[model samples]
Target: MAPGLPTPKKYFVTAGAAEGSTPLNAFDNALLAARIGNVNLIRVSSILPPGTEFDPNLELPPGSLVPTAYGYIISTTPGEIISAACGVGISRESFGVIMEFSGKCTAQEARAQIENMIREAFARRGMELVDMKIEAVEHEVKRIACALAAVPLWY
Candidate 1:
């Protein structure tokens, strides 16, 4: 955690896809498409803190260690549609929950699945949903392809 930084009061969601000659390059391209390619991603579990706000245009500096909850899929099978999605459910009590999914499916399906997961998570915790955020991406593989969705927490 960065010293003197606010307690991650804002966050953002992003999704993207890309194709390349290799799996690693495809994944990097996906990250570039998602506009977080240069940062060091510190992947965390799905949980949005109390009082957290959403920012659709949030940008972190290159090489920053960003904490995120994310899902991704890579496909080498030609013509395969790989998709990823993430959903967030904000509770009236000030916290939020996140769910992520990735598989060989349409982006819409992946998004729907994550949304359902978020709803179930909130229900299990007896939390009332006050807001929601969803993001999804899909890629059809010619050689190597990757798709990813993420919720990046900011301080």
Candidate 2:
């Protein structure tokens, strides 16, 4: 947490609208700025297009109201990994990623761990966290399937 920083803020993420969307809404624009600008995202309370609020803390369903967007949290790793995977000694400064199925319960289960992995990957490559842009949307088909399979059949 940074000094004099606000916490527990509600961010509204919209699809097909970056920062330049008509009928601009303060909440939506603020959320977009926070994410595009790489501000620490605490939690996304609500989203648009119906059935997108997937709150793990509350153990809610995949469809809450927040529509699937894509691209979640961006770290300093993907860039290095992409470069390394391609057999490059030097990598770019930052990498932009689209977190497929961010709001899907099944896919989101591994999100935290995956985020850590991304961070580690960047650290190994000797890169620092410059900025991150996350796209949140409905969970991907594959990720949802994986989550379903992970659950117990008797449940």
Candidate 3:
């Protein structure tokens, strides 16, 4: 097989909320709050490689090309609440699934959407879901604010 990134053996879920002067800056600040701002995040589709372990304490270096599944919401309206959530559903011995959702809603609503999506993904694949990890955050916008949730896959 041609060389490529090795299958990830560990992963982590993170959530952050922040406000900034601009939309991009708000998102960036949210990333910083999530502890993943320094690395280059390569957005990937929803899939958790088999046998991957959840490591919430995993520390990644700056400037690394990290594969991630994430969701975020940026709202400029004052007093508006925006929420985002990311979830992973794992089977006993099979490749898992990741789900993400964002909207102008509460964090609990975003989390509920993720949970349903993950369940549907597993059901469609005929896989028995055994476990899940989820992260969610909400932001009340003053000027520009972002709520972000992520599942980062690592070596």
Candidate 4:
């Protein structure tokens, strides 16, 4: 690989959902809720650099190629509830890990599942958990519903 830019040092977690008549519209609305509707999302695998800073309210310029690890669920069944969740585990000595889950469930359930996944991931790597962040979203389908959770990594 050509020498890439340095590892990301900043990151943020976000989740959102929306209902629309069509799947695409619902996805767009959900992105709007997550505050990343305008950017070109480049989905990446889950890995956060050590020492990375977390920004609770970070905003990206429009059209930026944002890298993120995310999970999403879309449903068309009326009255069905769908949820998505993402979690990040920071390690004291190495890069952090991220886990995501999506399903027909409550936001709390999704969050709990991803938290367990993050803990297992850290334990598998024998890493010490220093901190963590989790976010989740739930949507009830009237026509179509979409839910998403993500960790957006910034340089």
| lDDT by candidate, in order shown | 0.88, 0.26, 0.93, 0.89
RMSD of each: 2.3, 16.8, 0.8, 1.4
Q: On residues 53-76, what C-alpha lDDT tens digit does candidate 3 reach at each position?
A: 889899999999899999998888
Candidate 4: stretches off by over 4 Å: none
Clashes counted in candidate 3 amount to 0
- Which of the two candidates, 1 or 3, achieves a greater TM-score against the reference? 3
How much is the lDDT of residue 83 in candidate 1? Answer: 96
How much RMSD separates candidate 4 from the native structure?
Answer: 1.4
| Candidate topping lDDT | 3
Tens digit of per-residue lDDT, candidate 1, span 1-155: 65773457779999999997899899899999998888989888978989888888888999998888988998999999899998889987667998889999999899889888988898898888877889999888898999999989987
Which sequence of candidate numbers ranks them by lDDT, best first? 3, 4, 1, 2
- By TM-score, who's the top model here? 3
- The residue pairs in collision within model 1 are none
Model 1 lDDT, residue 144, Cα:
91
Per-residue lDDT, model 1, residue 121, is: 91
Q: After superposition, how far is residue 10 of candidate 2 from its true place, in Å?
A: 28
Per-candidate count of clashing residue pairs (backbone under 3 Å): 0, 20, 0, 0
Q: Measured by C-alpha RMSD in angstroms, how accurate is candidate 2? A: 16.8
Q: Over all chains combined, what TM-score does candidate 1 have?
A: 0.93
What TM-scores do the predictions have?
Answer: 0.93, 0.23, 0.97, 0.94
Any runs in candidate 2 off by more than 4 Å, and if so which? Answer: 1-110, 138-155
TM-score of 4: 0.94
- List the lowest-lDDT window of 10 residues for candidate 4: 4-13
